[model samples]
Target: MVGTYDLHYYQIDQIKRVRIVRRSDGCYVQFCIQADRNVDIQPAGKTIELDVGLSAFYTDSNGLKVDNPRHLRKSEKALKRLQKRVSRKKKGSNNRKRAVKKLGRKHLKVSRQRKDHAVKQALCVVKSNDFVAFEKLQIRNMVKNRRLAKSISDAGWSQFTQWLEYFGKVYGRIVVSVPPQYTSQNCSECGEVVKKSLSMRTHICKCGCVLDRDHNAAINILDKALKQAGYQLSTVGHTETHNAWEPLRW
Candidate 1:
């Protein structure tokens, strides 16, 4: 309480809890604010589905690609160098402590970057589209693949999805998570289930439809989400929104 404080406008009654902590770099405080959750925000009149992947952060239904900023991979060399230096230093030495702090700071920077990226991207997506659909990915199980564990973790899908849900709540947008079952295998054009391997980057169907694999998947995801949400869509080319949501039994 001795130093000047930068604070947001908050009512005394609205403040639920506050906690302060000291860090290697600085001291910070966290506040849990109480407020009404009933918020009404108008839809943006547009809908989009997102396909998240290691190759890119996301590919939207419109074929827009958001590049994945591999914060850890980008700074891996520097982090490794600092970690190696730290390991070589004598244990319990001041130099070793400093080196360790440096490494920790580097990691903190990456964490901040990933969170920042997720927040901004999620906000933009929520604000731009009224209805947003994404695959219901099981990150815990997905990370079990040792071959893709690093890339998947680095992509920060969980963080991104959390931000998406948060923003969706704030903006009153419809954010739905559709099952990831065959969204990629089924053709977005003719509804044909063309089997393909993970290595195939392009989706080709016998119905003369050839599209980017992610883009095709995004379309399918959107369709499924709309159906699950009670909207009957014609196709990817011509999408129509319905007011009623009736569960269709296949």
Candidate 2:
């Protein structure tokens, strides 16, 4: 067989198995290699929480927001054009087949883009902190909301979180997922349940605590993770009831 393949990097480890799969664009080979991937990374001695959102990719506990790429939204115009062409072509015809192929290739491009973005962002987050906390979001349930479903899917939260966990394991960092309940509604400072609609971007509490909604939620996520991990915060010092916390399984 005559074919071309691009090897991005070479693996020195023994290959356990290989598989070939066909995609819209091309056929690709995947290698399952056996090797120890663990690496030594100096502890940053810092913890962070991430709140994923449609408005921004995520807001960190330190008040930093990463803008959402909206990959599908950006490519929707081209995809629509290709799809229309496919529909216009007669069924069981060469023209229709070509048009469909074009549409499929465009979709494959968007998928790769999402994966790239997720991998880079997740690696950065894992490398920057010793402990990472995020919400245990039920993405399947969230996508049932027709009004916000597209936006949620475009954010690629599921892919991002998967990468975060993978990188955490490789780098020997802790990535924990806490319950999503009331993280956004509860005030981080005073523990008051300040109810606000989705339109309300800022969180304001009666106890003189004001913060951006996502920022406040990020802090609350961190707190929840720490408490769950048996860490007690005090003004003078910190106390730990346990030495380690296990990452939640998906």
Candidate 3:
């Protein structure tokens, strides 16, 4: 929605409203089971739910907000161990070949784990919500941050969008994108945009509102989408708490 992009409207459905917000998972939502199943392939619209193996309790003065990601400790440990083992093995030797294979498998496992986690979360978002919000990623400019390119790629925004598209169609959800021009620097509460470097993670508006930069951007995206869908600004936050993406409780 932020950058140069187009929505391929496959079903020719009319969008009543477009609200692009961040992926929010309720308390006790997880996706490890969906990831662990030894199925060769998964069918689309076949909604499967599970606990992602973590407990989350995030709140602020406003109320409970987004759940922090969990289940990454094990994967991080596995990756470090594999990297160390690969380092000690003789290069181009049989032992090195075996080490390389082990490393590859670890990477595969990590990849699969992340994919499973993302899909379940995305699907939950599709099911309980209407207007899905996201930054129109300027992927090219994003990739230009050479140091962060790999991690950003790993975050899989595009893949999440792709999955959102599939689930949106399946559940009759409307997807919308807004100009991602200033979702971060601009305050979602107040219409103010400031040019800040990427390192500034906190958005402090002179209007006496301070918010985490990423979250500020996320809600702004939702605002933009709703406007495009012809909804008045007053109705935007009316259902914030009641309309949360609640998946299977752990």
Candidate 4:
């Protein structure tokens, strides 16, 4: 079959398998390649941690915050319109099929937007820091809460982490996931566990430490990751010894 193809990236290795799948927008060809992909990245000489949330896509230990794109939320109106159109049409008729297809395409667009955002953010984080740490969240369990499920899913935490690990492997950077417990509750400066509700956005401790909740959490995550890896804060960002890029499996 003759078809036009666009290469998103250069294929550097032998093709292991090929699969074709149909989607609402169009058909796509997927290629599975076997290659040890590695890029030489100079040591960034910095260590950073990330805190993911619904309000913000992520807040880094350096006080940088990336706004959440909220792809699904942004497209909800269009999706609802399309869904209504689909329902109004006669069932199993050509018009109904057309309406359903349009709805499917809109959903596909939102999904793609979410994925693109995640990939760019993850890659940027991995490339800018020599050592990267993020909280290991149980997304499956978190989504069980009906109130926050939509927001949590929209945040795409799982996708972001997957790409973070993938880029870390490809770029020879260190990526570690630390436990989520007390990351937000503990004060970064004093290590005091001050209890606070989810609505409380500021972290305050008697040790004279005050910080944004997410910012404090990011710092704690970095500390936990460093301790888990048996490395001191001063030792990070030095030299890449013994292939530290391999992710520490917890």
For model 2, how does the per-residue alpha-carbon lDDT over 93-177 read when each residue is reduced to its tens digit? 9999999999999999998998899899999999978788899899999999998899888888999999999999999888999
lDDT of 4 by residue, 1-250 (tens): 4345433444755677889999998888887767688998787766678999767999988788999988899899999999999989998899999999999999988988999999999999889888888999999999999988999899888999999999999998889999899999988887888998888988889989988999989988987887888865455442343245335422
Give all TM-scores, in the order shown.
0.88, 0.88, 0.61, 0.88
Candidate 3 lDDT over residue span 84-159, tens digit each: 9989988889998788778777776666666776688677766765545555667668779897665555555566
Screening candidate 2 with a backbone cut-off below 3 angstroms (N, C-alpha, C), the clashing residue pairs are none
List lDDT for all candidates, in order.
0.82, 0.84, 0.54, 0.84
Please give the TM-score that candidate 1 achieves against the real structure: 0.88
lDDT of 1 by residue, 84-111 (tens): 9999999999999999999988988988
lDDT of 3 at 142: 78
Model 3 — which ten-residue stretch has the worst lDDT? 46-55
RMSD of 3: 14.2
- Angstrom error of the Cα, residue 73, model 3: value is 7.9
* Sequence-dependent TM-score of model 3: 0.61
* Candidate 2 vs 3: which has more lDDT: 2
Error of 4 at 243 (Å): 15
